[model samples]
Target: MTVVLLLCIITSQLTVVLSSAGNFWTYKGSLGADHWHLDYPHCGGIRQSPIDLQTRDVVVDQTYLSPLVFSGYDRVSNLFFRLENNGHTVQVGLNDKTMMISGGGLGATFVAEQFHFHWGAVDERGSEHSVNGRHFPMEMHIVHFNKKYGNFSSSVGKVDGLAVLGFFFEIGRFNEHFQEIIDHFGEIQFKNQHININSIPMIDLMPARLTNYYRYHGSLTTPPCFESVTWTIFNETIEIAEEQLVEFRTTIFENDKSDGGVFMDISDDYRPVQCMFRRRLYASHPSLKYDMASPRENGNDGVSNQPTRLLFSMFLVCIWCILPFFSF
Candidate 1:
């Protein structure tokens, strides 16, 4: 049988596909081309689906707040500011007092992991999925973990228990302000190694209309293809210069060129889009529309109210879902 692009490449194990676009490893197979779909022979398991996450719609009614304050862990990454808690790089903590509704899995405190970018080698047109059938320069995923689970391994190969924030990147000139992330790309020194990087702010890398993202329950689109996380993809596209995309991907050798005759040059690291599985979609949450639903008596024993580095406009909409779920 001919394998389909974007979806339909099926097997019992995860496959890592290396392309000029980047390196993507998948368990349920991956898309060969952009916007491709496939028959999901394996669906319905709690930890099966990879993309297009769906869950009970939780309505957030109360005001949301979290610490924009955070630090970066990786050096070569383009994430201007990121936060980590319980091994997660970017995360948020929400409690009942600050929460409002429960249905689509909102009001849960999820930790932010390392933020990264994806781009084409030459420039223009590397991301999956197009607007009105149009593709953009790249896509950025601000991955997160559900504090309810307590750890990544606990939530591993699992969905309905996590959240991932997605945003599209358009090609343009590198914003001078955006360079804060670009500045440190050289410091990372190597891949897979992490450090406690400081001073990066989450506010600088965000758009103003964070409340207006499309919410859905999707899989990690990575290995194990667990349909366990919630996705909030913004309708708006952010701009980064063609040169900026270049700068973002470029990596330096850990040692001096003279010390070792060969210092490896690295570039292009990203996870590709997985099968859509023709999954059903859900309606956006009401509290996100800035509507405060009828108040529930705030319980004293609930998630604590905390600020976030990248959990933009989210705490208010996610407070209610925090109390109902927990993983150890």
Candidate 2:
């Protein structure tokens, strides 16, 4: 089967529309972040996301933390994906069974549903979550739904229903793998436009170091801003070329240029940092105190079941090799 056909079948089973109420929400003017709560109550909730993560304030709790783990994230063969320009953000949907995460401070297994990004008009500020009030050029959110809560839509309304792995991006060397997604941005320049890509090395998008991270409870950055997320922010940042950053900021939000509607630039899709109520942030690594030691270098034994990963990989490889021989 073709990649598009496969993606259609997969999306039919896992797609979810997360738009807000009747009124539309943008990042500026009246319908901006300051007024989102007027339409979506959860946007004004106390446990909102995009908070400034202060290193000095965060407590070091090595006992309750685990190394971040990515399961089935290294799919490089016979993989199919769906990319959509949902007006609000550029979202790429993936099959849950193929990419998942467990451990690494997450109490339950979460299935990868989709991943999207939030960038700025320039390189100065774009990241939603900042480190000691320092913002990066852009931020990527790898969103996952708790397996126990069923699908992505169902999980959003319940506490502990979602897990978002956030990574900040700095302008530097070119990321070739990330270009696969960037190259297709033209096709989905308008609202609701979607296309299927052959494959993307999802693991390559993340930084090499996954051991050091911050853990906290928060809500969705967009409305309805459901406070049902377990957030994990990595300490390291991904480097992308300046040209790649330009491609992202140039994406349009209108359905067509021919229409009278203004061609809104999809530059600042990120929400401002919300107030950090009384929530305590936890770090996986040891704090800079006068006593405790850093976590074990190799403690992050990803995916506890080695046999399961091997068996799943073997099964996928076998299927890939014989796929052409059989009719779907």
Candidate of highest TM-score: 2
TM-score, structure 2 vs. true: 0.79
Runs in model 1 with CA error above 4 Å? 1-107, 193-195, 252-272, 282-328
Candidate 2: stretches off by over 4 Å: 1-21, 77-79, 254-258, 287-328
In order, candidate lDDTs are 0.45, 0.81
Q: Give the lDDT of residue 27 in candidate 1.
A: 19
The 10-residue segment of model 2 with minimum total lDDT is 287-296
Local distance difference test, candidate 2? 0.81
Deviation of model 1 at 37, angstroms: 16
lDDT by residue for model 2 (123-192), tens: 9888999886778999999999999877998898889899999999999999998999989998999888
Task: Give per-candidate clash totals.
Answer: 46, 0
- Writing each residue's lDDT as its tens digit, candidate 1 over 76-143 gives 24322332221111122211111111323366665664455545445545554333234456666766
